[model samples]
Target: MSDEGRRTHGFRRRTPLGAARERLLEQVTPHGRTERVRLRDADERILATDAVAERPVPHYRRAAMDGYAVRAEDTFGASDRSPAQLRVGETVGPETATRVHTGSELPEGADAVVMVEETETRGESLTVFDAVAGGENVAPVGEDVEAGEALYEAGHRLRPSDLGLLKSVGNEAVEVYERPRASVVPTGEELVETDPEPGEVIETNGQTVAQYVERWGGEATYRDIVTDDEAALRAAVERDLDHDVVVTTGGSSVGERDLVPEVVDDLGEVLVHGVALKPGHPVALGVVEGTPVLMLPGYPVACIVNAVQFLRPTLREVGHLPHTDPPTIEAELTRKVVSDPGTRTFARVQVDRDGETVTATPTRASGSGVLSSVALADGWVVVPDRREGLDAGDVVAVEDWEWSG
Candidate 1:
């Protein structure tokens, strides 16, 4: 079989990066299972149901500042020229005023507050030098949040502020989506566990890919490495079919020894192979026995790119988590980057943010096998397929890598 034939299961066609991503995401079926947990334990978990407030915040009107509550009309037109003097006590009315501290309920007839700085208090009488409008310096009932209000929407991930909000709304427990379970399989004959000498390559992508899976809201399980045998690779994939998703590293390219695409074809259907993406073009997407299987290239940088570009989204969608873009910043390139016009390139760059200027310099290396290149990078800049390359000093948006912590 031709190289292209083997890669695409005899179809000999390469899918565009955007189209490939969409295709793989379409195959993901979100898990509907959820569980209840205490609000304290809900941080970083996706809400399975909307959280509603049981009672209005600040159910009763209270003072908002350290001032005396008084009827606004009584203090009207009262200034330094001729201050208005009134008696101080509860049940304030015309010619009468009350002294209520911050957060204290106002007297029944009082409708506003006179700051202490604007009032001179005597034993039983107070003189107001300034006027205040009704409801001034007061927190009305439900001013912060109303009763039955939706505090958080479904699929919202709980952050630190979210936990505080939930507690304020009287939610002791919350319903959140159960973390989806995933398995990672590393395969290749020339790979070793560790301490690889000379010709042997260490099988390190599995752990890194598994970490990504866990970071994206999945429970990841790293499987034992398999040798370069079609039957063994197929068996490993079959054993992991019960998991919500399976990710296999290495042997995804179109070579005589590359058996991932062939195994996927025999077990299920290869949805796509050979994405139009630099450093990670050998990615493959398929489904085996109703489980999504994502194939990643053996190279380290390729594994990182494919995992961030494809696997992260797939796992998030399947796990019922919100797909939110990471924070990004605009930076000027300090050096030129060359890329094929037909392929979308992701170049790692180290960003130096100084005051108003953000300088992005390409990492020391750009090879797919260089893991340190990405490790030293702060973010990635993409050169779209329509552009041949990016020139130095070009202003571009740098996307933050998926956060693992």
Candidate 2:
């Protein structure tokens, strides 16, 4: 791993961000796997088939208030001065009323429910002080959902609120597309999990990528650091081919220690080597054994940017999840953000609001290695490839990158 054996730089020509993304995505496709899962295990799962209701919610007529189920016309024109009296019973008739509570099943021959506050019960007799029309204060069959109703179509991501509706429709389990499985392997000889001395770095990229995978609706398997060696890198990749996507962090550049891209290229084909991206131009993409292999930059900020651009979309595609754009907010730039004319830049900035105006101030620690800059930033302002820089006082939209919703 000395300079004498360093790999030559591959940036003879860098691919534009759009072209690189298109190339990478062309080789990736959905796994198309589906499985049945109980409601307890189906949170955030995508439906694989149309969900139709077999049974209507609240199949029986129900009381909507606490009082009595009685004929609506029996209490017409009745009031506290001259209340309508009826005998209490299990069933309702012209002169009889059945006591009921909210959500209670309506008794036979009852057309409506009279509220408890509008009626009084005395010695097995009920007195109604208010008038009610037919079907008032009552939930009839199919009020919430009718039988044979199509609740959801395929390719729909289920939310927490959806479980109750499915349950009410008699669905104890559902068929859903499998979550994309990701193998996040961290590589670098100088990487250590803890107690890092000088020249050694604490491993965090794998964990960060893994967590992001989960947040983006995929499953992640985080692995230990794979040393900077061709054999070790190849084995690490081979071990995770079963996963939907293989993600490797660190050693992705042209340095001698950056052997991941080489290993991937030797095993398969490197779709993209260098991209016209700021702080993360060294990111590489390839496919090995039909699995997309993503080689991210070692620097924390660079890795994050590349992950958000590449891995996030790859996971969504493989898992059959829809691509979601991160939320954004408009803000005024407090300082000029310089960018190369042909390179796409994501400038991290601290956001603040003054009365009615929001401001974005570029962080001092803006280098690829400055992880704190990106961490403290509320979001990022993207300077397009055509724009040289954004001047101060210019209004820009800052993407709320952390909001998954």
Candidate 3:
């Protein structure tokens, strides 16, 4: 029932995923520094303050189409059989019509626009062929948005259309939260840069974790690979304590070479040593020099799962990202997958959408060390700790890999 037992037995008594997440979130405080950025450069940045419109969009009443501006009554009783002729004038009046093009300013006293196709111009007079109601085919002032309205509220993540909308409302710049800085350190004696011998493994989890950190709205600093030496690994993590958060992949298990947990404990405090999640049970949550430190498993899939389950949420919390669930779709399982009842499992599956019915098939390579399993998967389906497994034809919500978080 202790943390030590949980680590050795695949989370038989491991902390629940939700409890672990809550503990980490409780310790995270958003990087609340506000900095003004150009509207064009504000995409994907979380807003630190509300953006109020200085002026109404469009700012003027204009014609929505090419037509002749006139009073609604002036076009009354006009049809293909019975046409009404009105004198062309410089200004709009009951007895006068003024020629206007699309987006042109409407003349004074003009309340409607009759399409140019509906009128025939002869000399200084226009013969109307149809009748238009008041305010018809004309755009009123503030039709899109009114002045002094809030375009975006604090904590809102700016999207591409948000940029255009802010520009439409005359916002040239905006205040956004400063992105949190994350330091990623990869440790293992067998880790190599590029060329790997028979016993050596290519070090890529650092890059993977860094990319995930960046995608979750934090700035990532990928440190060089560290060997299994305790002093070297400890020094590398200690040097990065100045960053907002520290993440280390490998050296997290209970093996003799595993030193991250010890380093974190010696430097500060270890909050959590293991979790009840398959392929991610070896994750370590701790603090080093007042900064949050997360230790992930060395296996590629385990690294990915731990990063998503813990690191992503931590980054989002500290970076002030919007609290929104990752995009998901409901799909029926193509086949049954057995899972340990003691641990929650996140199995990668490929989803096939055929009309309304969606089917999810498990990836061929499901091992924790297989990196291709994640690459080939479209999303993941979670089996809760209380549930034995999912049955074939059972509906499950699949978290999209690209849109989740």
Candidate 4:
């Protein structure tokens, strides 16, 4: 066979996920700009610096329940059999013991809290049965978090709970990293705008990519749906070169209308042409105008998977945010999985953990175009390329579809 025929038939084999990821990381450099932002607008933003508590949480000692506070010694040795009676005026000051409710502060000279339920009220005196302990129902100062302590380290992503923590620490404003901006371009001749006629497929990748970008803490500032024409693709990519990151879908493979690689070569350098993973083998990475541009496959599943595997991590790395792996658990396969020995395969699976056994239901369709399988799956199983296949009842690691808690 000629070199062209051999190249067309089989030349470069698929790499394993680990090796592919390493190569990608080596090719791409982190974005080198950081800006400070306010906490109010810092939701999902990364923390460029560690946030220390401005002051001790619960700055003052507060009551935990509404009850009269008194010295514990005065109520000791008091029981139902022989109740101890103390005059209200002698035991506590005026307006202190007459009536108390939950979370009421203890009056001066009182050292312990006596619950109302433990005492029987009379005309001017009260009968006490149970003994009380000092500081039993009080929330001491700095009980939850100490002053000058680090609340969150640098590179932490601010969540709702983190905002609440900031509020508790009397922090009205906090410094965080500015959100990175991204541009998305979807290219395909068969794809039409969301509102399309009968045979044309509606453009869904842009919307999906935008949503995923937002969820991953990057703002999709530019979105354009272009045809497979090389000129249109190059123009769209050039327009989006000013963004921190640019993403284009379709036209990335070795087809007649595959203009992504050509445009990248014309505008900048192509870092990678293919990855060693199923559903996203034709993924491309490039740099243009000092901004990173990722060319993802056209299929919905392939696009989504590549977005998570590549784009999400890149954004987090450049934004100085911590990236966590998807939740995972051990599960037993319900059936066998036959796969090639070249690429790492991600199989859609439905996982249910009952008692100690986790059952995984493999989906029938694993095609890159099958978006429904991803939606229907509870998680996914990673089948290494070196392994021939997974037998029924084999225990494997299952990565959860969504982050839980």
Candidate 5:
């Protein structure tokens, strides 16, 4: 049996989701393009090379507090009962001290700092009430990082705080992998951008996919909607051959109007034309001119579901980014949800919290065309192929599907 309807002529065999993913991923290689970017603009960029500190942080010894810098021995054996007497001078020497503020360079011959509160100033002399050992209150060279130290290895995903550390170590720019490029093409005959007539509908899949691509650490370009003509679809696909991946929102089914698989096959090859996944069995994975192309169904929910399961991982793989799964929560099912056997299903559910009890209720609109069913739901409960259905009161792990978006 197929993922959605009765086995159709369009797809002779529907590949399992796990098998389809593995087949497509095995052909993907990490992006090799690298660019040098300034530290300020390098946040979230994947490092292309290992980073090493060229210079030591705080290259000089500095005072760590506001006080007088003096030789350690001058403040030794000093206390409230019998304070040590030291002469105030321009430079630190034997029995002499110089005033220093926090972060100030330590004066020559001074090995310690006596806090201002610990001593009192006298005419041409200073009173020390605390005994400071050598190197006390003094930050030595390379205190934060040593020169020639390894900072981050290659393939490290940089964060804002990491950039700060890189800058402090004298890095103005660094090398990073270029973000994977994607072209989102929406195709359908009865689709419009804005107001739709009685027979026409508003186009949404391309815009939705483009945004998701960006969020997944890839660069996305949303193309205008193409009609259901084979020539137009072929031209649209060929135009974006330079991108790492191309995604089409319509014309993926086996019907006469669905011509993406044929168009892709003409240029290169279709790896998998159908997948064993609910709400999106018509999904197709292919490669054209060395670039992976994902063909999604025209239905709103089906397009979104296929994009999350297939396109999301494609972007991460091509961009050399880590694929992080959305967090899940275990909740009691308020109602039973029937699923087609042998087909992986994603059931939209609204979650409610009461005191400490959490419950998930299946949404009323479960059809593939009902976009609001998934949009308004909190998360989704995945029903594996093995189970025919989930009973009421069954504890299910509901994934926060849109959390990453």
Candidate 6:
């Protein structure tokens, strides 16, 4: 049989997740070009170059409070019993006697600030009983950041605070990697888009996969729901190969109606299928016309899980962005969790943290069709096949939802 013909046959065995991830990384390449984008448009985009500060953050020494700017020496030894009085103009710079509010620039000859509450103000003259040290309540220039300093390093994702800092340094625009474009195709005759009239199932896997693609910094521009005909599937894959990555849901398993792998094999090469993981074990990885195509299962939860586990990482790496695993924290299992002896399992869990103690609430249904369970879940716990089950109070790593609050 030809190399392609071998892959068309049912998967021989399950591949480990670590090996699968390494292979996907090796097969995918980074995007070729970068673009300069406005700072406002750069949020969540990965930086291509280091951003240097053109000037100090504050740029000048300013008052920290609304009070009197005074020379500490002028008020030295002053007290409520033996108060020292001086004409405000003579003690400081001419016209410096004008009151200044917080964040206002300090006037010349002013070395310290005496809060308004500390001094009893009269018509033209003021009496100060308290003495303040010089330079107190002053924010010096370059205190927050130095000029010519690296504000944000390359590969940094632009967050709200990063954007604010960039704008503070007078950067209206920044250079960042362009987001990758993707196409999604859902294949199967029995599959329906949504709310099928009768004798049909709704097509939700495509939408689930598309959402995952977008959340991982890829643009899902094209989405098609097509029948299981090989010609139709081949044409869809060929048209979508123009994109950086093409994602197809359904038809990856060994079922009689499954045709995605066959079509992909005819078009290009299938790198892997039947990963050694539960729920999404039938996932397929392939390339068509030099563009990567990720074939996920038809079940909603399965599609989303596989996209996050495999496809999202590939897209993030290709865009020159860091690939981060879901945030994890050690949490106590609320109850015992049983699993198959040889296959790795991921259980949706609800987590509640109190101070340093965390509790995991395992979901009732972990099936691939239970999309609602994922929504209600705060995170997921990995159950290694070798372990019998997790006991209560045992600490386990919990992979949090991407947007967990």
Tell me, by TM-score, which candidate is best.
Answer: 5
Model 5 has a clash total of 0
Please name the candidate that would achieve the greatest lDDT relative to the true structure: 2
Q: Could you tell me every candidate's TM-score relative to the true structure?
A: 0.84, 0.89, 0.87, 0.79, 0.93, 0.81
Candidate 1: global Cα-lDDT? Answer: 0.87
lDDT (tens digit, per residue) of candidate 4 on 233-271: 888988887777889988777776777877887898877
**Residue range 1-405, candidate 6, lDDT tens digits:** 355554556677878767777787787888877899998889899888999988897898888888888776777887789875755563465323446678888777888777777777677677777777888877788888889989888888889899999889778899988888888888778887667877698887887777767777888864668898889888888887778888898888887778888789888998888887776889888887778888899887778778877887888878877767678888899888877666677888898889887899788887888888787888888888576667777899998656311
For model 3, residues 141-177, the per-residue Cα lDDT tens digits are 8888899988889989999999999898888999999
lDDT for model 6, on a 0 to 1 scale? 0.80
Clashing pairs in 1: none
Q: Rank the candidates by TM-score, best first.
A: 5, 2, 3, 1, 6, 4
Error of 6 at 1 (Å): 9.6
lDDT of 5 at 255: 75
| Residue-by-residue lDDT tens digits, candidate 2, 293-351 | 99999999999999999999999899989898999989999999999999999999989
Looking at model 4, the pairs that clash are 65-102, 65-103, 66-101, 66-102, 66-103
- How many clashes show up in model 3? 0
Lowest summed lDDT across 10 adjacent residues in model 4 is found at 90-99
RMSD of each: 3.5, 3.1, 3.6, 4.4, 2.8, 4.2
- Per-residue lDDT for 17-98 in model 5, tens only? 9999998887777779999999999999989999988788888999999999999998779999999999899998999999
Q: How many backbone clashes does candidate 1 have?
A: 0
| lDDT agreement of model 5 with the native | 0.90
Clashing pairs in 2: none
Scored by lDDT, model 4 comes in at: 0.76
